[model samples]
Target: MEEGATETPEELLAKQHRKEKKDLQAKIQSLKNAVPKNDKKRRKQLTEDIAKLEAELNQKHEEELKQLKSPADTKVGEMINGVEAMTVEGGDQQEVKQPRVTKAQKRRDKKAAQEKERESRIAEAEVQNLLGERHQEGLKLAQKLAQRQLQIREISSDGHCMYRAVEDQLVQRAVPGLTLVLKELRSRTAEYMRNHADDFVPFLTNPNTGDMYTADEFEKYCSDVEHTAAWGGQLELRALTHVLQLPIEVIQADSPTIKIGEEYDSEPITLVYMLHAYGLGEHYNSVERLKDPANEEDS
Candidate 1:
Protein backbone atom coordinates (compact mmCIF):
# COMPACT_ATOMS: atom_id res chain seq x y z
CA MET A 1 0.00 0.00 0.00
CA GLU A 2 1.12 3.56 -0.73
CA GLU A 3 1.86 5.97 2.10
CA GLY A 4 -1.29 7.52 3.68
CA ALA A 5 -3.43 4.87 1.96
CA THR A 6 -4.82 3.44 5.19
CA GLU A 7 -8.52 2.88 4.43
CA THR A 8 -9.78 -0.19 2.54
CA PRO A 9 -11.92 0.35 -0.58
CA GLU A 10 -15.14 -0.46 1.30
CA GLU A 11 -14.26 1.90 4.12
CA LEU A 12 -13.38 4.67 1.71
CA LEU A 13 -16.64 4.17 -0.17
CA ALA A 14 -18.57 4.33 3.09
CA LYS A 15 -16.82 7.54 4.06
CA GLN A 16 -17.70 9.09 0.70
CA HIS A 17 -21.31 8.06 1.11
CA ARG A 18 -21.40 9.64 4.56
CA LYS A 19 -20.00 12.94 3.22
CA GLU A 20 -22.60 13.00 0.42
CA LYS A 21 -25.39 12.30 2.90
CA LYS A 22 -24.19 15.14 5.10
CA ASP A 23 -24.27 17.55 2.16
CA LEU A 24 -27.78 16.41 1.24
CA GLN A 25 -28.94 16.92 4.79
CA ALA A 26 -27.65 20.49 4.73
CA LYS A 27 -29.58 21.23 1.51
CA ILE A 28 -32.77 19.72 2.94
CA GLN A 29 -32.41 21.80 6.06
CA SER A 30 -32.17 24.94 3.92
CA LEU A 31 -35.33 23.93 2.09
CA LYS A 32 -37.09 23.43 5.39
CA ASN A 33 -35.99 26.93 6.41
CA ALA A 34 -37.31 28.33 3.14
CA VAL A 35 -40.75 26.66 3.12
CA PRO A 36 -43.53 28.43 4.93
CA LYS A 37 -45.35 26.58 7.69
CA ASN A 38 -48.89 27.40 6.50
CA ASP A 39 -48.35 26.39 2.86
CA LYS A 40 -49.32 22.76 3.12
CA LYS A 41 -49.20 22.10 -0.60
CA ARG A 42 -45.67 23.42 -1.10
CA ARG A 43 -44.59 21.72 2.12
CA LYS A 44 -45.92 18.39 0.85
CA GLN A 45 -44.13 18.83 -2.47
CA LEU A 46 -40.83 19.46 -0.68
CA THR A 47 -41.38 16.38 1.48
CA GLU A 48 -41.81 14.21 -1.64
CA ASP A 49 -38.67 15.66 -3.22
CA ILE A 50 -36.65 14.87 -0.11
CA ALA A 51 -37.94 11.30 -0.09
CA LYS A 52 -36.95 10.76 -3.71
CA LEU A 53 -33.35 11.91 -3.31
CA GLU A 54 -32.77 10.35 0.12
CA ALA A 55 -34.28 6.95 -0.77
CA GLU A 56 -32.35 6.69 -4.04
CA LEU A 57 -29.09 7.72 -2.36
CA ASN A 58 -29.54 5.26 0.50
CA GLN A 59 -30.54 2.37 -1.79
CA LYS A 60 -27.56 2.90 -4.07
CA HIS A 61 -25.25 3.09 -1.07
CA GLU A 62 -26.63 -0.19 0.34
CA GLU A 63 -26.24 -1.92 -3.01
CA GLU A 64 -22.62 -0.76 -3.22
CA LEU A 65 -21.96 -2.02 0.29
CA LYS A 66 -23.37 -5.42 -0.62
CA GLN A 67 -21.27 -5.55 -3.80
CA LEU A 68 -18.13 -4.75 -1.78
CA LYS A 69 -18.88 -7.71 0.51
CA SER A 70 -18.09 -10.13 -2.36
CA PRO A 71 -14.70 -11.95 -2.38
CA ALA A 72 -13.78 -10.91 -5.98
CA ASP A 73 -13.16 -7.29 -5.15
CA THR A 74 -11.71 -5.92 -8.35
CA LYS A 75 -10.96 -2.57 -6.71
CA VAL A 76 -8.56 -4.27 -4.30
CA GLY A 77 -6.90 -6.14 -7.17
CA GLU A 78 -6.62 -2.91 -9.13
CA MET A 79 -4.96 -1.18 -6.18
CA ILE A 80 -2.51 -4.05 -5.70
CA ASN A 81 -1.65 -4.14 -9.42
CA GLY A 82 -1.80 -0.34 -9.75
CA VAL A 83 1.93 0.23 -9.26
CA GLU A 84 3.51 -3.26 -9.10
CA ALA A 85 2.31 -6.82 -8.96
CA MET A 86 3.63 -10.36 -9.62
CA THR A 87 2.20 -13.15 -11.81
CA VAL A 88 2.12 -16.66 -10.34
CA GLU A 89 3.05 -19.53 -12.73
CA GLY A 90 3.94 -23.16 -11.91
CA GLY A 91 4.29 -22.45 -8.19
CA ASP A 92 6.75 -19.62 -9.01
CA GLN A 93 6.08 -15.90 -8.80
CA GLN A 94 7.47 -13.60 -11.54
CA GLU A 95 7.30 -9.81 -11.77
CA VAL A 96 4.73 -8.74 -14.37
CA LYS A 97 6.22 -6.42 -16.98
CA GLN A 98 4.83 -2.91 -16.92
CA PRO A 99 3.00 -1.70 -20.03
CA ARG A 100 4.83 0.97 -22.02
CA VAL A 101 3.11 4.38 -22.06
CA THR A 102 2.89 5.45 -25.71
CA LYS A 103 3.67 8.97 -26.99
CA ALA A 104 0.14 9.28 -28.41
CA GLN A 105 -1.34 8.53 -24.96
CA LYS A 106 0.95 11.15 -23.37
CA ARG A 107 -0.11 13.74 -25.96
CA ARG A 108 -3.80 12.98 -25.36
CA ASP A 109 -3.33 13.27 -21.62
CA LYS A 110 -1.51 16.61 -22.03
CA LYS A 111 -4.33 17.91 -24.28
CA ALA A 112 -6.96 16.84 -21.72
CA ALA A 113 -5.04 18.64 -18.96
CA GLN A 114 -4.86 21.81 -21.06
CA GLU A 115 -8.61 21.66 -21.75
CA LYS A 116 -9.33 21.31 -18.03
CA GLU A 117 -7.12 24.29 -17.24
CA ARG A 118 -8.86 26.39 -19.88
CA GLU A 119 -12.27 25.48 -18.56
CA SER A 120 -11.24 26.39 -15.02
CA ARG A 121 -9.94 29.78 -16.20
CA ILE A 122 -13.20 30.54 -17.99
CA ALA A 123 -15.25 29.63 -14.92
CA GLU A 124 -13.12 31.86 -12.71
CA ALA A 125 -13.57 34.77 -15.10
CA GLU A 126 -17.33 34.31 -15.10
CA VAL A 127 -17.41 34.25 -11.31
CA GLN A 128 -15.28 37.38 -11.07
CA ASN A 129 -17.56 39.21 -13.50
CA LEU A 130 -20.63 38.18 -11.55
CA LEU A 131 -18.95 39.42 -8.36
CA GLY A 132 -18.80 42.97 -9.84
CA GLU A 133 -15.11 43.34 -10.74
CA ARG A 134 -16.16 44.69 -14.14
CA HIS A 135 -17.57 47.77 -12.39
CA GLN A 136 -15.07 47.81 -9.51
CA GLU A 137 -17.98 47.80 -7.02
CA GLY A 138 -17.56 44.72 -4.83
CA LEU A 139 -14.40 46.05 -3.20
CA LYS A 140 -16.02 49.36 -2.25
CA LEU A 141 -19.17 47.70 -0.89
CA ALA A 142 -17.11 45.10 0.96
CA GLN A 143 -15.03 47.80 2.60
CA LYS A 144 -18.16 49.61 3.77
CA LEU A 145 -19.66 46.42 5.16
CA ALA A 146 -16.44 45.68 7.01
CA GLN A 147 -16.73 49.04 8.75
CA ARG A 148 -19.80 47.68 10.52
CA GLN A 149 -17.85 44.52 11.29
CA LEU A 150 -20.00 42.94 8.60
CA GLN A 151 -19.38 40.92 5.49
CA ILE A 152 -21.48 39.92 2.56
CA ARG A 153 -23.34 36.61 2.56
CA GLU A 154 -24.01 35.83 -1.08
CA ILE A 155 -27.51 34.65 -1.93
CA SER A 156 -28.31 32.48 -4.95
CA SER A 157 -29.34 34.50 -8.00
CA ASP A 158 -32.26 32.22 -8.90
CA GLY A 159 -34.90 35.01 -9.13
CA HIS A 160 -35.66 34.67 -5.42
CA CYS A 161 -32.89 37.02 -4.36
CA MET A 162 -35.11 39.47 -2.47
CA TYR A 163 -36.70 36.88 -0.25
CA ARG A 164 -33.55 34.80 0.19
CA ALA A 165 -31.58 37.89 1.13
CA VAL A 166 -34.15 38.67 3.79
CA GLU A 167 -34.19 35.05 4.92
CA ASP A 168 -30.43 34.97 5.33
CA GLN A 169 -30.42 38.04 7.55
CA LEU A 170 -33.24 36.78 9.76
CA VAL A 171 -31.49 33.47 10.34
CA GLN A 172 -28.00 34.85 10.57
CA ARG A 173 -28.86 37.72 12.91
CA ALA A 174 -31.67 35.89 14.70
CA VAL A 175 -33.64 39.15 14.51
CA PRO A 176 -36.42 39.64 17.02
CA GLY A 177 -39.05 39.93 14.35
CA LEU A 178 -41.15 37.67 12.16
CA THR A 179 -40.30 33.99 12.39
CA LEU A 180 -41.11 33.65 8.69
CA VAL A 181 -38.81 31.66 6.44
CA LEU A 182 -38.19 32.56 2.82
CA LYS A 183 -41.50 31.10 1.57
CA GLU A 184 -43.36 32.52 4.52
CA LEU A 185 -41.78 35.93 3.87
CA ARG A 186 -43.03 35.69 0.27
CA SER A 187 -46.53 34.80 1.46
CA ARG A 188 -46.70 37.66 3.93
CA THR A 189 -45.33 40.20 1.46
CA ALA A 190 -47.84 39.15 -1.21
CA GLU A 191 -50.73 39.32 1.25
CA TYR A 192 -49.71 42.76 2.45
CA MET A 193 -49.50 44.09 -1.09
CA ARG A 194 -52.88 42.65 -1.95
CA ASN A 195 -54.51 44.22 1.09
CA HIS A 196 -52.93 47.58 0.34
CA ALA A 197 -53.68 47.49 -3.33
CA ASP A 198 -54.15 51.25 -3.56
CA ASP A 199 -50.56 51.76 -2.37
CA PHE A 200 -48.98 49.14 -4.66
CA VAL A 201 -51.19 48.66 -7.74
CA PRO A 202 -50.45 52.11 -9.09
CA PHE A 203 -46.74 51.23 -9.27
CA LEU A 204 -47.33 47.90 -11.02
CA THR A 205 -47.69 47.23 -14.75
CA ASN A 206 -48.42 43.99 -16.60
CA PRO A 207 -45.68 43.42 -19.17
CA ASN A 208 -47.61 40.78 -21.09
CA THR A 209 -50.58 43.11 -21.77
CA GLY A 210 -48.50 46.31 -21.77
CA ASP A 211 -51.03 47.97 -19.49
CA MET A 212 -51.67 48.70 -15.87
CA TYR A 213 -52.79 45.60 -14.01
CA THR A 214 -56.57 45.32 -13.84
CA ALA A 215 -58.26 44.09 -10.66
CA ASP A 216 -58.25 40.45 -11.78
CA GLU A 217 -54.66 40.58 -13.04
CA PHE A 218 -53.50 42.21 -9.83
CA GLU A 219 -55.06 39.39 -7.80
CA LYS A 220 -53.30 36.85 -9.99
CA TYR A 221 -50.02 38.70 -9.48
CA CYS A 222 -50.38 38.44 -5.73
CA SER A 223 -51.18 34.74 -6.04
CA ASP A 224 -48.03 34.19 -8.13
CA VAL A 225 -45.93 36.01 -5.53
CA GLU A 226 -47.23 33.70 -2.83
CA HIS A 227 -47.04 30.43 -4.81
CA THR A 228 -44.36 30.92 -7.43
CA ALA A 229 -40.63 31.73 -7.40
CA ALA A 230 -41.27 35.04 -9.15
CA TRP A 231 -38.52 37.61 -8.93
CA GLY A 232 -39.04 40.29 -6.30
CA GLY A 233 -38.42 44.03 -6.53
CA GLN A 234 -38.91 47.38 -4.78
CA LEU A 235 -42.68 46.89 -4.32
CA GLU A 236 -42.01 43.57 -2.62
CA LEU A 237 -39.45 45.23 -0.36
CA ARG A 238 -42.01 47.77 0.79
CA ALA A 239 -44.49 45.01 1.50
CA LEU A 240 -41.84 43.13 3.49
CA THR A 241 -41.20 46.18 5.66
CA HIS A 242 -44.86 46.28 6.65
CA VAL A 243 -45.20 42.50 7.03
CA LEU A 244 -42.06 41.83 9.02
CA GLN A 245 -42.26 45.23 10.76
CA LEU A 246 -38.46 45.39 10.65
CA PRO A 247 -36.41 48.01 8.87
CA ILE A 248 -34.33 47.04 5.84
CA GLU A 249 -31.31 48.93 4.58
CA VAL A 250 -29.77 48.47 1.19
CA ILE A 251 -26.19 49.58 0.44
CA GLN A 252 -24.93 50.14 -3.06
CA ALA A 253 -21.68 50.93 -4.81
CA ASP A 254 -22.54 54.35 -6.34
CA SER A 255 -25.91 55.31 -4.98
CA PRO A 256 -27.73 56.53 -1.90
CA THR A 257 -28.81 53.95 0.68
CA ILE A 258 -32.38 52.66 0.65
CA LYS A 259 -34.00 52.55 4.07
CA ILE A 260 -37.43 51.10 4.78
CA GLY A 261 -39.60 50.83 7.91
CA GLU A 262 -37.66 53.42 9.85
CA GLU A 263 -40.76 53.94 12.03
CA TYR A 264 -40.34 50.46 13.51
CA ASP A 265 -37.23 51.36 15.54
CA SER A 266 -35.56 47.95 15.08
CA GLU A 267 -32.14 46.86 13.97
CA PRO A 268 -32.10 47.22 10.23
CA ILE A 269 -31.28 44.14 8.20
CA THR A 270 -28.59 45.33 5.82
CA LEU A 271 -28.33 43.93 2.29
CA VAL A 272 -25.99 44.79 -0.57
CA TYR A 273 -27.78 45.52 -3.82
CA MET A 274 -25.67 45.08 -6.95
CA LEU A 275 -26.63 46.48 -10.33
CA HIS A 276 -23.76 44.74 -12.16
CA ALA A 277 -22.94 41.84 -9.85
CA TYR A 278 -24.35 39.28 -12.28
CA GLY A 279 -24.81 38.84 -16.01
CA LEU A 280 -28.48 38.09 -15.37
CA GLY A 281 -28.67 41.52 -13.65
CA GLU A 282 -29.70 42.71 -10.17
CA HIS A 283 -28.72 40.64 -7.11
CA TYR A 284 -29.01 40.97 -3.32
CA ASN A 285 -26.72 39.68 -0.55
CA SER A 286 -27.07 39.89 3.22
CA VAL A 287 -24.61 41.73 5.46
CA GLU A 288 -23.75 41.05 9.07
CA ARG A 289 -21.00 41.89 11.50
CA LEU A 290 -17.98 39.65 11.32
CA LYS A 291 -18.97 36.43 13.09
CA ASP A 292 -15.99 36.60 15.41
CA PRO A 293 -15.67 39.94 17.09
CA ALA A 294 -12.13 39.07 18.09
CA ASN A 295 -11.06 38.68 14.47
CA GLU A 296 -12.15 42.17 13.51
CA GLU A 297 -8.56 43.32 12.80
CA ASP A 298 -7.94 40.60 10.23
CA SER A 299 -11.18 41.53 8.44
Candidate 2:
Protein backbone atom coordinates (compact mmCIF):
# COMPACT_ATOMS: atom_id res chain seq x y z
CA MET A 1 0.00 0.00 0.00
CA GLU A 2 1.11 3.59 -0.62
CA GLU A 3 2.60 5.23 2.50
CA GLY A 4 0.46 8.37 2.13
CA ALA A 5 -2.72 9.08 0.18
CA THR A 6 -4.78 12.28 -0.05
CA GLU A 7 -7.93 12.04 2.04
CA THR A 8 -11.13 13.85 1.16
CA PRO A 9 -12.72 16.25 3.71
CA GLU A 10 -15.22 13.56 4.68
CA GLU A 11 -12.45 11.00 5.30
CA LEU A 12 -10.45 13.51 7.44
CA LEU A 13 -13.56 14.43 9.44
CA ALA A 14 -14.39 10.77 10.05
CA LYS A 15 -10.83 10.04 11.19
CA GLN A 16 -10.91 13.03 13.61
CA HIS A 17 -14.27 11.91 15.03
CA ARG A 18 -13.05 8.34 15.53
CA LYS A 19 -9.89 9.50 17.37
CA GLU A 20 -11.89 11.88 19.62
CA LYS A 21 -14.46 9.15 20.45
CA LYS A 22 -11.72 6.60 21.22
CA ASP A 23 -9.88 9.02 23.52
CA LEU A 24 -13.10 10.05 25.30
CA GLN A 25 -14.15 6.40 25.79
CA ALA A 26 -10.73 5.53 27.23
CA LYS A 27 -10.87 8.51 29.64
CA ILE A 28 -14.37 7.56 30.84
CA GLN A 29 -13.41 3.92 31.37
CA SER A 30 -10.26 4.89 33.29
CA LEU A 31 -12.26 7.23 35.50
CA LYS A 32 -14.87 4.54 36.19
CA ASN A 33 -12.22 1.96 37.10
CA ALA A 34 -10.25 4.32 39.38
CA VAL A 35 -12.99 6.32 41.07
CA PRO A 36 -13.93 4.99 44.53
CA LYS A 37 -17.35 3.31 44.68
CA ASN A 38 -18.17 5.07 47.96
CA ASP A 39 -17.38 8.52 46.51
CA LYS A 40 -20.78 9.58 45.16
CA LYS A 41 -19.49 12.89 43.80
CA ARG A 42 -16.69 11.27 41.78
CA ARG A 43 -19.00 8.50 40.51
CA LYS A 44 -21.62 11.05 39.48
CA GLN A 45 -19.02 13.09 37.59
CA LEU A 46 -17.77 9.95 35.81
CA THR A 47 -21.32 9.04 34.81
CA GLU A 48 -21.92 12.52 33.38
CA ASP A 49 -18.67 12.39 31.40
CA ILE A 50 -19.61 8.97 29.98
CA ALA A 51 -23.08 10.18 28.97
CA LYS A 52 -21.64 13.25 27.24
CA LEU A 53 -19.03 11.24 25.35
CA GLU A 54 -21.65 8.65 24.25
CA ALA A 55 -23.94 11.40 22.94
CA GLU A 56 -21.05 12.90 20.94
CA LEU A 57 -20.11 9.49 19.50
CA ASN A 58 -23.69 8.91 18.37
CA GLN A 59 -23.77 12.31 16.65
CA LYS A 60 -20.48 11.53 14.88
CA HIS A 61 -21.83 8.13 13.74
CA GLU A 62 -24.89 9.83 12.20
CA GLU A 63 -22.67 12.37 10.40
CA GLU A 64 -20.41 9.57 9.05
CA LEU A 65 -23.45 7.72 7.75
CA LYS A 66 -24.63 10.84 5.94
CA GLN A 67 -21.16 11.30 4.44
CA LEU A 68 -21.03 7.66 3.21
CA LYS A 69 -24.47 7.95 1.57
CA SER A 70 -23.57 11.13 -0.35
CA PRO A 71 -22.80 10.64 -4.04
CA ALA A 72 -19.15 11.24 -5.01
CA ASP A 73 -20.00 13.38 -8.07
CA THR A 74 -22.67 15.46 -6.34
CA LYS A 75 -21.69 19.10 -5.59
CA VAL A 76 -20.81 19.81 -1.93
CA GLY A 77 -23.91 22.02 -1.49
CA GLU A 78 -26.20 19.25 -2.83
CA MET A 79 -24.59 16.72 -0.47
CA ILE A 80 -25.18 19.13 2.46
CA ASN A 81 -28.88 19.28 1.43
CA GLY A 82 -29.06 15.40 1.78
CA VAL A 83 -29.02 14.70 -1.93
CA GLU A 84 -27.70 11.10 -2.04
CA ALA A 85 -27.91 10.79 -5.85
CA MET A 86 -26.81 13.36 -8.43
CA THR A 87 -28.91 12.03 -11.35
CA VAL A 88 -32.52 10.88 -11.84
CA GLU A 89 -33.45 7.40 -13.19
CA GLY A 90 -33.85 8.60 -16.83
CA GLY A 91 -31.44 11.58 -16.47
CA ASP A 92 -34.09 13.95 -17.82
CA GLN A 93 -33.35 16.74 -15.28
CA GLN A 94 -29.92 18.31 -14.60
CA GLU A 95 -28.85 20.26 -11.55
CA VAL A 96 -27.71 23.81 -12.32
CA LYS A 97 -24.25 24.75 -10.99
CA GLN A 98 -23.32 28.08 -9.48
CA PRO A 99 -21.46 30.48 -11.81
CA ARG A 100 -17.75 30.86 -11.12
CA VAL A 101 -16.60 34.23 -9.84
CA THR A 102 -14.78 36.49 -12.38
CA LYS A 103 -11.09 37.24 -11.98
CA ALA A 104 -11.85 41.02 -12.07
CA GLN A 105 -14.19 40.73 -9.06
CA LYS A 106 -11.57 38.79 -7.05
CA ARG A 107 -8.89 41.34 -7.99
CA ARG A 108 -11.11 44.24 -6.95
CA ASP A 109 -11.86 42.63 -3.59
CA LYS A 110 -8.16 41.98 -2.94
CA LYS A 111 -7.31 45.59 -3.85
CA ALA A 112 -10.00 47.00 -1.52
CA ALA A 113 -8.79 44.83 1.38
CA GLN A 114 -5.20 45.96 0.83
CA GLU A 115 -6.29 49.61 0.66
CA LYS A 116 -8.15 49.30 3.96
CA GLU A 117 -5.14 47.67 5.64
CA ARG A 118 -2.83 50.41 4.30
CA GLU A 119 -5.12 53.14 5.66
CA SER A 120 -5.19 51.45 9.07
CA ARG A 121 -1.38 51.31 9.18
CA ILE A 122 -1.13 54.95 8.14
CA ALA A 123 -3.48 56.04 10.95
CA GLU A 124 -1.53 54.04 13.51
CA ALA A 125 1.76 55.59 12.36
CA GLU A 126 0.26 59.11 12.66
CA VAL A 127 -0.76 58.49 16.28
CA GLN A 128 2.67 57.08 17.14
CA ASN A 129 4.27 60.10 15.50
CA LEU A 130 2.24 62.47 17.67
CA LEU A 131 3.24 60.58 20.79
CA GLY A 132 6.90 60.52 19.79
CA GLU A 133 6.89 64.29 19.23
CA ARG A 134 5.36 64.90 22.67
CA HIS A 135 7.86 62.54 24.26
CA GLN A 136 10.80 64.39 22.62
CA GLU A 137 9.45 67.71 23.90
CA GLY A 138 9.39 66.45 27.48
CA LEU A 139 12.92 65.08 27.13
CA LYS A 140 14.10 68.49 25.91
CA LEU A 141 12.62 70.16 29.00
CA ALA A 142 14.19 67.58 31.34
CA GLN A 143 17.55 67.99 29.62
CA LYS A 144 17.31 71.79 29.87
CA LEU A 145 16.56 71.54 33.58
CA ALA A 146 19.43 69.16 34.25
CA GLN A 147 21.67 70.63 31.46
CA ARG A 148 22.22 67.09 30.11
CA GLN A 149 20.72 64.52 27.72
CA LEU A 150 17.70 62.42 28.77
CA GLN A 151 16.04 59.19 27.55
CA ILE A 152 12.55 57.79 27.94
CA ARG A 153 11.67 54.35 29.34
CA GLU A 154 8.13 53.59 28.20
CA ILE A 155 5.51 51.44 29.92
CA SER A 156 2.77 49.32 28.37
CA SER A 157 -0.18 51.52 27.26
CA ASP A 158 -2.90 49.10 28.31
CA GLY A 159 -5.49 50.70 30.66
CA HIS A 160 -3.21 49.71 33.57
CA CYS A 161 -0.30 51.82 32.32
CA MET A 162 -0.45 54.15 35.29
CA TYR A 163 -0.22 51.30 37.77
CA ARG A 164 2.47 49.57 35.74
CA ALA A 165 4.41 52.82 35.46
CA VAL A 166 4.30 53.26 39.21
CA GLU A 167 5.43 49.67 39.51
CA ASP A 168 8.42 50.43 37.29
CA GLN A 169 9.33 53.48 39.37
CA LEU A 170 9.02 51.50 42.59
CA VAL A 171 11.21 48.75 41.19
CA GLN A 172 13.82 51.34 40.30
CA ARG A 173 13.56 52.65 43.85
CA ALA A 174 14.57 49.21 45.34
CA VAL A 175 11.08 47.65 45.78
CA PRO A 176 11.60 44.84 43.25
CA GLY A 177 8.85 42.51 41.92
CA LEU A 178 5.95 44.84 42.68
CA THR A 179 3.59 43.71 39.89
CA LEU A 180 0.94 42.13 42.17
CA VAL A 181 1.35 44.92 44.72
CA LEU A 182 0.58 47.53 42.05
CA LYS A 183 -2.59 45.68 40.96
CA GLU A 184 -3.87 45.76 44.56
CA LEU A 185 -3.29 49.52 44.57
CA ARG A 186 -6.49 49.89 42.57
CA SER A 187 -8.50 48.22 45.31
CA ARG A 188 -6.84 50.39 47.95
CA THR A 189 -7.64 53.51 45.96
CA ALA A 190 -11.27 52.42 45.61
CA GLU A 191 -11.50 51.88 49.34
CA TYR A 192 -10.13 55.35 49.99
CA MET A 193 -12.63 56.90 47.55
CA ARG A 194 -15.47 55.08 49.28
CA ASN A 195 -14.39 56.31 52.68
CA HIS A 196 -13.78 59.90 51.58
CA ALA A 197 -16.51 60.27 48.97
CA ASP A 198 -17.07 63.90 49.90
CA ASP A 199 -13.47 64.88 49.15
CA PHE A 200 -13.28 63.27 45.68
CA VAL A 201 -16.89 63.12 44.42
CA PRO A 202 -17.13 66.88 43.88
CA PHE A 203 -14.16 66.75 41.48
CA LEU A 204 -15.39 63.68 39.56
CA THR A 205 -17.13 64.54 36.30
CA ASN A 206 -18.08 62.62 33.17
CA PRO A 207 -15.85 63.86 30.35
CA ASN A 208 -18.28 62.85 27.62
CA THR A 209 -21.47 64.33 29.09
CA GLY A 210 -19.89 67.25 30.97
CA ASP A 211 -21.91 66.39 34.09
CA MET A 212 -20.63 65.83 37.61
CA TYR A 213 -20.77 62.21 38.72
CA THR A 214 -23.83 61.30 40.82
CA ALA A 215 -23.29 59.34 44.01
CA ASP A 216 -24.34 56.06 42.38
CA GLU A 217 -22.30 56.76 39.25
CA PHE A 218 -19.23 57.57 41.31
CA GLU A 219 -19.67 54.34 43.28
CA LYS A 220 -19.91 52.32 40.05
CA TYR A 221 -16.85 54.09 38.66
CA CYS A 222 -14.85 53.24 41.78
CA SER A 223 -16.03 49.64 41.55
CA ASP A 224 -14.88 49.41 37.94
CA VAL A 225 -11.51 50.94 38.82
CA GLU A 226 -11.11 48.39 41.63
CA HIS A 227 -12.39 45.17 40.04
CA THR A 228 -12.05 45.70 36.28
CA ALA A 229 -9.26 46.81 33.88
CA ALA A 230 -10.70 50.30 33.79
CA TRP A 231 -8.40 53.21 32.80
CA GLY A 232 -6.87 55.11 35.70
CA GLY A 233 -7.61 58.85 35.96
CA GLN A 234 -6.70 61.89 38.08
CA LEU A 235 -8.50 60.60 41.17
CA GLU A 236 -6.61 57.32 40.98
CA LEU A 237 -3.36 59.29 40.59
CA ARG A 238 -4.03 61.22 43.78
CA ALA A 239 -4.93 58.02 45.60
CA LEU A 240 -1.75 56.36 44.32
CA THR A 241 0.35 59.28 45.64
CA HIS A 242 -1.07 58.72 49.11
CA VAL A 243 -0.81 54.93 48.87
CA LEU A 244 2.86 55.04 47.85
CA GLN A 245 3.60 58.06 50.05
CA LEU A 246 5.51 59.55 47.07
CA PRO A 247 4.83 62.79 45.26
CA ILE A 248 4.05 62.57 41.48
CA GLU A 249 4.97 65.33 39.07
CA VAL A 250 3.38 65.26 35.57
CA ILE A 251 5.41 67.01 32.86
CA GLN A 252 3.36 67.66 29.73
CA ALA A 253 4.43 69.32 26.48
CA ASP A 254 1.22 71.31 26.09
CA SER A 255 0.12 71.96 29.68
CA PRO A 256 1.50 73.67 32.76
CA THR A 257 3.48 71.52 35.21
CA ILE A 258 1.16 69.81 37.70
CA LYS A 259 1.93 68.11 41.01
CA ILE A 260 -0.25 65.63 42.93
CA GLY A 261 -0.23 64.23 46.47
CA GLU A 262 1.47 65.67 49.56
CA GLU A 263 4.03 68.44 49.16
CA TYR A 264 7.55 67.03 49.24
CA ASP A 265 10.70 69.08 49.86
CA SER A 266 12.72 66.54 47.89
CA GLU A 267 12.60 66.02 44.12
CA PRO A 268 9.75 63.71 43.09
CA ILE A 269 9.85 61.14 40.26
CA THR A 270 8.92 63.09 37.10
CA LEU A 271 6.65 61.31 34.58
CA VAL A 272 6.60 62.55 30.97
CA TYR A 273 3.08 62.82 29.53
CA MET A 274 2.28 61.67 25.97
CA LEU A 275 -1.07 61.77 24.15
CA HIS A 276 -2.53 58.45 23.00
CA ALA A 277 -5.57 58.28 20.73
CA TYR A 278 -8.22 55.58 21.22
CA GLY A 279 -10.58 55.38 18.25
CA LEU A 280 -11.62 59.01 17.59
CA GLY A 281 -10.52 60.74 20.79
CA GLU A 282 -7.31 60.97 22.83
CA HIS A 283 -6.20 60.20 26.40
CA TYR A 284 -3.12 60.86 28.53
CA ASN A 285 -0.22 58.45 28.33
CA SER A 286 0.81 56.76 31.57
CA VAL A 287 4.13 57.15 33.39
CA GLU A 288 7.33 57.30 31.30
CA ARG A 289 10.86 57.52 32.79
CA LEU A 290 13.59 60.06 32.03
CA LYS A 291 17.26 59.14 32.08
CA ASP A 292 20.35 61.28 31.52
CA PRO A 293 23.89 60.14 30.55
CA ALA A 294 24.60 59.16 34.15
CA ASN A 295 21.74 56.64 34.31
CA GLU A 296 21.71 55.81 30.57
CA GLU A 297 24.71 53.47 30.87
CA ASP A 298 23.09 51.60 33.77
CA SER A 299 19.72 51.47 31.94
Q: Write the per-residue lDDT of candidate 2 for residues 165-246, one digit (tens) a residue.
A: 6666666666533343556878888988888888888898889998989989999989998988787767787877766667
Please report, in order, the local distance difference test score of every candidate based on alpha carbons: 0.72, 0.60
Would you list the clashing residue pairs of candidate 1? 149-289, 149-290
The best candidate by TM-score is: 1
Error of 2 at 62 (Å): 61
Q: Which ten residues in a row have the lowest lDDT in candidate 2?
A: 276-285
Per-residue lDDT, model 2, residue 80, is: 40
Best by lDDT: 1
Clashing pairs in 2: none
CA RMSD per model (angstroms):
14.0, 18.8
Task: Write down the lDDT that model 1 would get.
Answer: 0.72
> Residue by residue across 1-299, what tens digits does model 1's lDDT show?
36635555666776778897897798678666654443344557779867866876686566556545645334333442353544455545566665565665456446545754764575465345445453357667766776677767778888888899899888877656555698899888888998899998888788887788899999999998999989887789888988878888999878888998898898887888988766677888877555553343244
Model 2 C-alpha RMSD to native: 18.8
TM-score of each: 0.54, 0.46
